[model samples]
Target chain A: MALRGRDIVSIRDLSTEEITEILDHARSMIPVAEGKKSSSALEGKVVATAFFEPSTRTRLSFEAAVQRLGGRCLTIADIGVTSMRKGESLYDTVRMLSSYSDAIVLRHPNEGAARLAADASDRPVINAGDGSNQHPTQALLDLMAMHETFGTLAGLKVVLLGDLKYGRTVHSLAIALAQFGSELVLSAPRALALPEDLRGELESLGAKISDEPELRRAVRDADVLYVTRIQKERFPDEGEYRSVAGSYRVDASVLDGAKPQLIVLHPLPRAGEVDPEVDRTPHAAYFRQAFLAVPVRMALLSSILAPTRGG
Target chain B: MVRELRITPIRNGTVIDHIANGLALDVLRIIGVRDLDKDSTVSIALHVRSGKIGWKDIVKVENMELSPRKVNAIALISPSATISIIRDHQVREKRAVDLPEHVTGVVRCPNINCISNQGEPIESDFRVVRRRPVVLRCAYCDRQVTDFLRHLA
Candidate 1:
């Protein structure tokens, strides 16, 4: 259960026990993260964030996790201002960073860049997000949110809505939930629905997934409703993006017929997908979900840097 | 008038039979026919009619035996092919080539952005996750590549 020197490249790499272990540790970290209890677990350890892509939430959360645990962060100022702009490859930058850091958290534009960086570096490389491939920690925090609402992850009717194809968070979350034997309902318009390759992969992993475009079909009798913003950049045609964006937006009124316990979660930076009206409703778990990142990530940082776990 | 067909048998070698028509050359390239033993001889028959298949090709190599990898690599080009190991002018062992669980250094990833395709000194590896309508999953990027022949390294 001690994830000492392991590379966190994909959520698929973790066993169910390991994921549960993480969630259990996250539960313990809540008091410490809230400053009710103090811990100096990671006093001297150093973490480096190599974000090649622009990020706000994931980046800041990791820095907060490390700092709150009394560890220093060697965050890369900007890749554009660094040697990367001078034509340095990800491998070279990662190897150089490994010399100065205990662990490297990498976010790159290429799908397998974290894998390449892990192979090159001498330290554990946690993938923040590599292109549209996966974001493991995001999935972990998301599972934490689900656990907070449902009390457990198994057998819950889970509905994933909007931009399933390009949304990395949804992709990782769906795969993680499949292990718990959840009946997945994929609700998105045809143009923005989950890709067939991923759907087949999920099916192979033993997840029952159905295409339910209408929110009503998915909301009824569902325990969890996961909504995501549909990126306009993903659409090649401006008109096509316009037509699908408004149809997927969920407001407070949309939840009128939904189950009272139906928890609506979004991996944020919403762009007209979830209406502002929904934010005040009991269904909105995203804001609380964002705050939960602190405790969950403190668990990751502490457990990863603990001396008991071997590389 | 009736015509008598004459064929020469090799003492030791492999006979790759029932290759699809117009792919004999591709099969040769896939198996690295150019790297054959100096003393070995290769005989090829292309665009020939067969009872089992509409149009077929056959290749015979003298003084050489093909490995399972080579056989699998050849199967990518010609799935219907049968590889027969000949010994002392007799077919000792024969079987149809089935796609291997993994194919490495045989076909390059079609994605140019993939690590295997980039100039990284990495061998191209693919997992044959599907058969019938052959699908090769790239080991690096997990991209499904269908056009197997076009990306041969």
Candidate 2:
């Protein structure tokens, strides 16, 4: 049952019970994450943030989590300035970092790079994001946000809106939610819908996923409405991207018919997918979701680095 | 009078029999045609009628025995296939090819973005998700792979 020295490369790596344990640990860290209380759970520990890819929230939140838990952070915020620019392999770099750090938080442009890093490092490795492959912590925090709002993870109707095809967060979160017995509804444009293979996998996992073409319609009975931007960079054809760019915007107006208990979430740095006006609504939990990153990451850091102390 | 097509058996080598019909060539591809010693004789029987299975294919190679990995690759393509080792023109050992729980380096992941395809210093690892259809999931990135032929490593 111990997660000490374990890697969080993908949500699939953690079972439902382990995910719940992490979420429960995150709940207890909220006060400390907010600086209202303090503890030295990660005292004398060093967590490294190695980012070969550009990221804002994930890297910052992980660093912030380490510091809040009374641990120091070694950050490689840019690859262009590091030995990676000299063609150093991820294996060599992580192996060197593991010598100085107790845990490593890695974000890389290559998919599955974290797993390779984990193999190279003796210390625990956490995948911040790996090129459309996985961001397990984001899925964990998303789960934490949902649990905090609803007090449960099972049997909730969740509508996944926007770019399901290229949105890594939605893909990982969808799989995690399915494992927890959540009923999923997909609300995305035809071209940007969830891949058939992933849909088949979810269906095989006994998850009931329904397709609703309209976001407004899909949110009618959903307990959670998770939205993602249609990434323009992922589209090879600019014209095709333009056609679906504004297809599914979630404004306050769209929430008119949604259930009062329905909460809206987005993995942010959004580009017109969620309206600014929607941020003021009570249903807007994306900010809370973003803020939950600290405590959730703190929980993860403690689980991997301080498991013996039950921090 | 109708006559059965016959090819001479080798004195010592291996016989891969009961491959699903029309898959004998794939078995050869898995075993690598160029890898076989040019001096040894190899025979392929395609779409051969069989009593146990309606139609089957068999491949016999002289002075060549398949490794467990190659045999596993053959199993992925043809689950019902059996491998027989011959010594002194006698069948020494015969057993069905068994697909191991973890398949390594046999096939490349179809995911272009998969780390296994990124020239990393590790062979591709797959978990056997389904045996009947032979579904493989990449151990690194969690991508499922079902199409095995074109992506053979």
Candidate 3:
């Protein structure tokens, strides 16, 4: 029941019970975050945000979460602007940051950067986002959103649209969703489809997964349309991103044939993927979803940094 | 008498048999054994035609206990390899090589960008997620490694 000082690098490390516990805690913190109630569970703790890559939502959410818990935040927003630009290795950077904080939240461009940082640091390291590998906190917030919206995650028809291969959020979400017995519809371009082995593993977990190139047919009867941007940054060639960028846009027109109660979710910073017009509709939960990050992350941070009952 | 292709018997050492043809060198590389010492005798036979399974390679190492870790490396490189552990000129243990839970300090990640490949004093750790399909997921990066690369280490 105690998760204090734990490094949250991946959802794979969390058991179903622990995940549910975190969700329960997140639910409790939601009212506090919306200014209906207040609790300073993480009162004297300090969180360090060490972002080696560019991030606005993830970084700020962690800061807001820490402040909401009556804790302070130390941020190194740009690695290029820090001592790292002067040739400090990631290990040294983490070692230095660990000395100043209780927990370190890392967003790095390398796949295993967070793990490496955790190994080097004295404090717990939370992976905010790691290069197309994992974003565990994002997965947590996503599950929290689903639970809040539908009241249950079991047996939901979720369709993940756009760039499965390069989308870190979807990758982590898919792994988390597998535990809930959710059927998945993956719609992406052939070049951007989920990896063959990930698909096989999900199938083994009894997730009814089907890949479709066309977005329209895939989202026709979906309960949740989880949209992700086609990350141009991950493409090896700029021309490849250019070729596939416009294929899976979810505009206002695209949702005409969608399920009546379809909740459209996007882990945003959108680039022409979800049209601006769709933001006014009832289906648009993306902004509210983004705002939910604060409470969910606060719950996560509090649980991770709180004192142990046995001790 | 079937005209036997002669192999000098190792006096008191392990013999790894049933290695897929052309993978003996790869197995050797994974085990970090490029050249055998003068005191430690090693014999390798490659591309030997086998009646049961087309062609195979065999490696014999004298005065050494073939660790399960080494056997795992052999499994990664050559899935069909059978390990025979010899003690006092007798086969003590013999079995088909199976993947290990965590293969540390052996069989480096094939990904060029992997931290293990960068000579960072980090051991390459792989968890055997699936045995039948022979998939090893890297502990650090979560990269699925199917093929063993010689140049990685």
Candidate 4:
């Protein structure tokens, strides 16, 4: 199917077949991104990334993806440094950015901000991250990583660790994971546990979900460990982040009794959660996970820009 | 049908039947119908046992046309409510009620910190995002307004 000029605001918008198509396209683009092959599909297309919030992986991965596809990127990293600080609304910023680029990737601290921007912009608006709401692209990339590691999601045992309450990535990923029959182990501090209604929804979708207090018990026999940082910025109080930060940490010693092929993943910007010593171990697939984002995003961009016939 | 037959007939007025008991006042409040005189025949039957549904209430207002807004408010209060609009001893309309898409100036967001709840004279606006579970997100605050604790305008 073609993906030209489509706004990827939520993973809920993609069916299982479309997600598989994106993964397939991403897998095909891996060789080209590694310099094994050459393709200039997005030659003259200009992609604009508007980050109103703090980001490193998402921004850089998008930039890399656009560049790898032979396209240019116009990035705005800080909202304060831009005209937004001088009394500009998000709608105005989107309208102005849309005129300059073929597609706009927006990351904002407000919930439903992407939808508002999408409504305003003539160009396609992809939601990079919205305030504790969704990060569709991250979910897509995580699915790609999981598919590459586990072969299929039919009966995979996946554990999502840390800050489920505030982590937009996990929320989006969990929603997407529900489409596939994946048993989930949600490990989080009591204060940062996943919302009850969402958990119920997942359970309704035939996902065998269990909440565990400790990270070790959650990841001991799990096929995948998806770790997220305790987002301090999302909390209105600093004490909340402080209280829940130490309870969930994955290190070399923690994985001593775990499965040999256990894939540990973290949506980066680590703050003493996962020990650096674990980076050398074959279990640490977070870096590869981060690198995997490029090709996935490339496929996403290509699908959005130059879709196949009858797509 | 037996529950409807239990309620006494009104000559020329609206009958809001099949409302859940103890919710009639809330329904009245939501529809902004508080100025009825004490002498006026405003009959309210509450906690009346009914077959199948266990218990329900019926309110018969004397000489009043049940507005669409009032019907919608009744629907929000009790989803299974039936509104019978009467005119000159004739049943004009009798059917199930439903709230409109853009419900303005009624049912304030319960969040105290919400802009609509700050007494700024702003209309309490909501769009029905999800119909099955009846999820209403505030137009101003974007907070999910559930059924249990909605503030009437």
Candidate 5:
């Protein structure tokens, strides 16, 4: 299937083969992502980075991806200075932006905001992050990092720890990993466990899921330890947020019993959920996971912008 | 063998038969009871015995025909409903209302965070996940919406 003129709003929108193809293209883009080589795949094209919400890594990652592909960027890093503050709807903003750019990268504070923008824009739309709903590219990049380390997504034991309920990155990543037939062991506080509906949906997709209450016990036999931060903004009450804050911490002691090849991944902007001392260990792949965003996003942008470029 | 009619037959309107048990009022709301003509006569029979189904409700109106949109709305609350258009005391058209594959603009998404409920210009679009006991999921937010009556648009 042709990916040209398509929107990347949810990881669920991609199939196993399409995801594999994207990852394969990402492998070839590593040199470009590292600035060791450059490509004009998106030359003479303008990609708009519309961040209605605050984001440091994803916005910079998309800008880096676009620039590395030899494309210029039209950025709106702040919503306060835009027409949105003057009572403009997201639809109108996306419609106007679609007229000026070849493709759009949208990040909004509302759930399903990217889905709404995709319908309004004529050009392809990439969901950078939409509230606590979905961040497809982040999941894709996470998959890229895992595939690079392990050489395959199938049959891997992945332990998802921390805030599963409100972490958008985990939601998409868990679903994508399940699609690749990975065994998932969920470890989190009872209050912050993954939603039951999502668990059922993942099971229906043929995922083998088990629950482990202890983080240390869950990590003992895991291949990948994906940690997430407890989000204070997602809780309805301050007391509820306070109760679960600092519930699980991954330190060097946690990995003492684990296999040497076990890799720890985190979608950064950490709030001390993973200890800084753990970064010195060989198990720290979160930084590499962060850097993989460029190649994965570059693969997506090139596939959408230049489909006939022999990806 | 013939059974007596529960309500007087209309000469030039519509007779909706085989509505699910105790759903006449919900059907009324779905068709917008307030939007009906004041001059038209409306009759409803609740919990009437039926040979096909155990018990069903029936509704008859005089001098008013329901639009296709209203007929589709009835399918959500009462899947077994059959509409018979009467013209000069004869059944002009008779057909069972069908639950459309895709429901649009009729029922609002119940999720507060859904894009359709964010005061945007986009209409609420849902894919019918199941029939019999109808289930609809929002196209934008992927939230399953089951109670259709309370969230009617």
Candidate 6:
């Protein structure tokens, strides 16, 4: 269960206790994150960031996490400049990256790219995001935020709204929350409903699930409403994307019937999923959700890079 | 004690009996019958009724003993198929094929952008997650595969 030298390819690879351990470490890193104090957990360690896909938030959070931990980082983005454009396979790139760093953080358009990288590399592989399959680190930070709000991850009435099918964060968070015994409410159009096999699996895990197509109806009794953007990039048809574009907007008016203590979280870079006016509400925790990524990621980097005593 | 057989039994080979009624040809494709030796005798019976499954198909291959990989593929397409290995006109080892926990190289991950599908040197591997619906999760992409016929590797 020790995260040291492990590949974080999926949230399923982590146990509930291991997840909580990382969160606890992240909480302790909050002071270091705010520059109130500093930790040299990765003073001499090197971490590599090889993002094959375009990103703003995830890449920045990882680079900042490495820097905060006093580790040297080498970033190579394949979106513009890399051998990946020259038809170099993920294995080749990952093999090369492993030679240069103690740990590698990877993001690819392919769903299982991190697993591929981890299988080939001796160094620890951290998945930033992989297609629409999983984002374990994101789920960890999201849980940390949930733990901050509710003081525990168990038994919260969690409503996951927006594009359930294509949102990687939604998939990982839903499964991880199920492992924590959260009551799950899924609200999405039929086109984007939770995959049935996954739903069946979650139900078998003793997590109660309810189908609520209307976002307002879904969040009325929610303790935590985790929203995700309906990614236009995932849909091939423009008209189909247009049809579901504004289907689940969360404004102050929409939250009128919601529980007063209900906290709303979103993996940011929202494309009109939440109203700007709602950003001023007490329920808006997306910004703090984003801020928590720094310390959480710092904890992850430190865990993987820190050397054990007796060496 | 026996009379003349309707179809002559093979001396040695595999007899796959009670295949789900219309999937004989599909099973042939999976086992690569076209690539078998020219001298081998292969017989297929379709729309056959049986006391067990009521409607079934049977395939008999002379001079070919199917590997575990082929048998595993048979389990996916026809969960109730029984593989009977005949030696010297006697049923030597007869057992019903059951799906293994992990199956590899049987079918491809349907996700087009899956790492297993990107011309990599990765053989498709699936973890048999559910049996009733025959759900398979790609070992690489975590994509659930239900349409097995479409994504046969």
lDDT (tens digit, per residue) of candidate 3 on A1-311: 46888999987878778888998988888887887787888888899998878898999988988887889999998776898777777778889999999999999877777777788888999999888888999988888888888998889989999999989899889988987888899998888989776787788878888776677888898889999999988887899988898887888888999887888999989988899999988899888889889988988899889877764
Task: Flag regions of model 6 displaced more than 4 Å.
Answer: B1-4, B47-55, B86-95
Better of 2 and 6 by DockQ: 6
Rank by DockQ (best first): 6, 5, 2, 3, 1, 4
Residues B42-121 of candidate 6: C-alpha lDDT, one tens digit per residue: 89999987999999999999988988888988899889999999999999999999999999999988888899999876
- Evaluate every candidate with DockQ and list the scores: 0.33, 0.62, 0.38, 0.15, 0.63, 0.72
Model 5 lDDT, residue B20, Cα: 90
Score chain A of each prediction against the true chain A by TM-score and list the results.
0.95, 0.96, 0.97, 0.96, 0.97, 0.97
B120: Cα error in model 2, Å: 1.0
Residue-wise lDDT of candidate 5 within B1-153, one digit each (tens)? 897866787789888999998999888877776777788888999999898889999988888789877897899888899999999999999999998988888888877767788888888888898896898877787677788889988
If you assessed candidate 6 against the hidden native complex, which CAPRI class would it receive?
medium
Error of 1 at A237 (Å): 6.7
Better of 2 and 4 by TM-score: 2
Q: lDDT: which candidate is best?
A: 5
**Candidate 5 to truth, TM:** 0.95
Clashing residue pairs for model 3: none
Q: Kindly list the per-residue Cα lDDT of model 3 for residues B1-153, writing each as its tens digit.
A: 897756777767778888889888776665555445559877899998888679999888877766666676777777788888887777888888876677776667665545555444467777887777677887877888776554233
**How well does candidate 1 match the true structure in TM-score terms?**
0.84
- What residue runs in model 1 are displaced by over 4 Å at the alpha carbon? A233-247, A309-311, B1-22, B29-43, B47-56, B60-72, B75-102, B110-121, B130-134
**By the DockQ metric, which is better: model 2 or model 5?**
5
lDDT of 2 at B151: 87
Candidate 6 has a TM-score of: 0.93
Docking class of 1: acceptable
Docking class of 4: incorrect
Error of 1 at B119 (Å): 4.8
Query: Against the true structure, what is each candidate's TM-score?
Result: 0.84, 0.95, 0.89, 0.83, 0.95, 0.93
